[model samples]
Target: MPVTYIPPEQRKGILESPILQMAMQQRMQQQERQFRERELKLKEQEMPVKNLIQMGNLAKSLSDLGLDPRVILGTKA
Candidate 1:
């Protein structure tokens, strides 16, 4: 089959057709949703580490004030 050259105006019209435009919008929305999901997963993974660091800081602060961290944090039975 011989490849016929398409005129630029016809190509532009095809690109601007409503069906193609809607498809492009749907593709963009899906990509955005995937990106947000990945971002949420990363933040969820980071939360435990962030909490651990905060706890460590609080323990250190208590120790610096001459308080036993274990006693204040209720580690002893």
Candidate 2:
């Protein structure tokens, strides 16, 4: 494929165009927003798992002390 040579002045103009600049900015903002949303989702998922592990540990400790875990956990007998 033959490379089309754009004159330097035209190339500079294209690069400096306001429309292109705005599009680039919007694209960058979109990417950043997506990244932050994904991070938030991962953190949200992690909290539930962490809470479940902590609850399990607490239940085990309570059972070891001969206490009814279901009662402490608010489950029906």
Backbone N/Cα/C clashes per model: 0, 0
**Per-residue CA lDDT of candidate 1, range 19-41, in tens?**
99999999999999999999999
Number of the top candidate by lDDT? 1
lDDT of 1 at 59: 96
Lowest-scoring 10 consecutive residues by lDDT in candidate 2? 68-77
lDDT (tens digit, per residue) of candidate 2 on 1-77: 99898998789888899999999999999999999999999999999999999999999999999998999999846
RMSD of 2: 3.2
Candidate 1 stretches with Cα past 4 Å from truth are: 1-7
